[model samples]
Target: MSTTSPRRLHLNVNILHSGFVPSAWRLAHADPRAFVDVAHYVRVAQIAEAAKFDAVFLADNASIADQIDFRPITALEPTVLLASIAAATSHIGVIGTASTSYNEPYNIARRFATLDHVSGGRAGWNVVTTADLGSARNFGRDAVPVHAERYACADEFTSVVKALWNSWEDDAFVGDKTAGRFIDTSKVHPIEHRGEWFSVAGALNLPRSPQGHPVLIQAGGSADGRDLAARHAEAVFSASQSFDESASYARDLKSRAAAYGRGPNAIRVLPGLTTIIGATEADALRRRDELIDLIPWSYSLTRLAGTLGVPADTLKLDERLPDNLPLPGGGNGNHTFFHATLAQARTHGYTARQLIRALAGGGGHRVIVGTPEQIADDIEHWFNGGAADGFNLMPDALPDGLQDFVDGVVPILRRRGLFRSDYDGSTLREHFGLQRPVNPHARMETPVVAA
Candidate 1:
């Protein structure tokens, strides 16, 4: 609460296959093969970049977590796909998800560092702990680790990555042809790190990146998750359905970051938002219904049951969620989404079928169906009300859904002075108004002892 003018909003479009809805691929205009098409992704990114969006995010899972029979899965590797996007677009940031649970710290560090260079410092890493047993099994584990253990590993993983990124000083490369010196040997240092999770003798293969370190992002809602984010994350993709809940979460996260000696604005909380836009309210509702109608009840039920850790048959389409439903393993495996789904059910008394429609783009995040004016109002409310720094937008369909929002809502935001009308900076850090991190090992002073 600095009582200052509000910070400009930030938005990133999550390009989820064809779209957020399960049946988006079946839309008359959507290409069923878009999920595997690099051109499809590039087209979407170009659209977002043209609109002055801050970034385009791609979420990943090690296994086929979704019901692939009905919908397209998140198939391509994020970093590789983002490289193609980077070559196509100039300003928009490219963020890709990589799990701390399954991947080595060294490889993760090199991958993102390389991407940062390829994108000219417009790369971001969304740190996630793989929660599903399917992903664990794919990585050779029979079961997912307990909540606390996963976070412990993540803590170490992130630390090692940051250390490796700092191994080479920004000025390490002198490249003087007359002296035949390509690098300043004295300026390079090894991070000699050995920890429970990772061990690295560093001095990264590449020099320091343009943005120092690519922006670090996190998406989790459990106590451990929030603590990790407060300690390290520069941005958080949240799952909150209501304004009050989102606002409360923002305050708590900012306070936690402050306690860790970070500024109040250190972490930007961006809740997931699904928008189904139309020229009229009726038109929007009709489109939402059309998408919902295409999704089978069995698919929605099974999906919900998986998150709840209960039998699909146990849930009735017309009945309320069981009051005695137990929290999954003391709140593990998508803790944020499980609780958010429950909150929506209990607060609004939505029957299972109604709940499915309410969460047409799968649940957990908030959904808005309206004309551009109404959508703009909702976005303004969240940004001005301290409920969010911005949003991780998941449009109903790719290209088309994103096109509508960009053409419709973006102009409104620009008119109201709520968003930028043009690109203001070249790097992701500059776009988000984040400071580039200084290399901890670059310049240091030795302590003097008094005798």
Candidate 2:
């Protein structure tokens, strides 16, 4: 028998509106208004916490980027919704997406830092760049910024955010009655950051958060995106349909992180996995079919076209995707989803109709339809094989679908010694087996403040 300890798998349930399936809200049991309901999110989070899942994540959008006429888009501001989730549940970490494109470094830094404090260190920020013209217009831009420019801004934005997070030493706060000093001014230093995109004056107004810094999580799959993740993100939410793809992604990302002087295992890779479960294989297949059948062909086609960055009219339902399709919007469209969607279609020679079915009603993530045992096996294989550190699960439907997994798959994982049966730590960092960041400013005797 091997004496080495078993690898611990992480699981974070993405509290996507309704579910991963666009038609999920139309289900008899689902509430169409759940996207805006704080209670719905709270309840979903509670379920995850009960099962000892590592975290509960929220994907955000600045504008209505989905087929809002037929489905619920990601409407609620993630940090606010996640704050509600944190209040209701005690154990699950709350990670929310906030784009660097529209917001300033200081505000984003302070918002998440405050969230970290409020959640007792269970908050994480999923860094993203706005790639849609709709979102750009929301921020008063007629068009999206170039891809390289966005990533460059993200790198600097992240750097400045980090510097601010570390500006105040851990012991900066010293409330001693005798000394009559609430804080040591010397311990708090200014970041004094000036970059191509942003210029910020000294230290943040607040001290460092409970996790030292809330865990930095990112979700991007392009070359530039990977470099951003490797340089700054502690964990990455990936979109890989197959084990080989995920393995290749993990290897490349870790190597990039290593080049930045971080450990090879520094970044945890968690791919998106949408689950549609049933007691039997046939039942699961039927469930998937039902969900697919519920969605209008028009909705799926438009959504698929959007992912591919092509016009809906460009695709014929029965034909394969056109070869050598250039990057959309003159190569400024969302590169990650574009490539991922194209790969799935090309690999299987799936026509537009078949691709729609394969993507589970036209989204760009891996979908699985199976019994609890079958799902567990897939999860186990990925975790043990180093293809993924864990998964950001998107169930077919909310509450019920998530509840099914907790009841069925979690038990199997525990039995196999692949997942945690209970909470071993309270902070998000602990849940992911990461350490709290040390305040680099502490090492310096004095830090300069920008005038």
**lDDT by residue for model 2 (310-427), tens:** 8999989999999899988888888877888888998999999999888888578998899999999999999989999999999999989999999999999999998998898899
lDDT of each: 0.92, 0.91
Assess candidate 1 and give its TM-score to the true structure: 0.97
**Which residue runs of candidate 1 sit more than 4 Å off their true CA positions?**
1-6, 444-451
**Model 2 regions lying over 4 Å from their true place:** 1-5, 444-451
Candidate 1: residue 277 lDDT (0-100):
96
TM-score of each: 0.97, 0.97
lDDT of 1 by residue, 1-451 (tens): 5876547999999999999988999999999999999999999999999999999999999999989989899999999999999999999999999999999888999999999999999999999998898998988998899999999999999989988888888899999999999999787888888988788898688988999999999999989999999999999999998999999999999988998999988988999999999999999999999998888889999998887878899999999888878767556678888988888888899999888889884957788999999999999999999999999999998989999999999999999999998877999998888999988767766889899
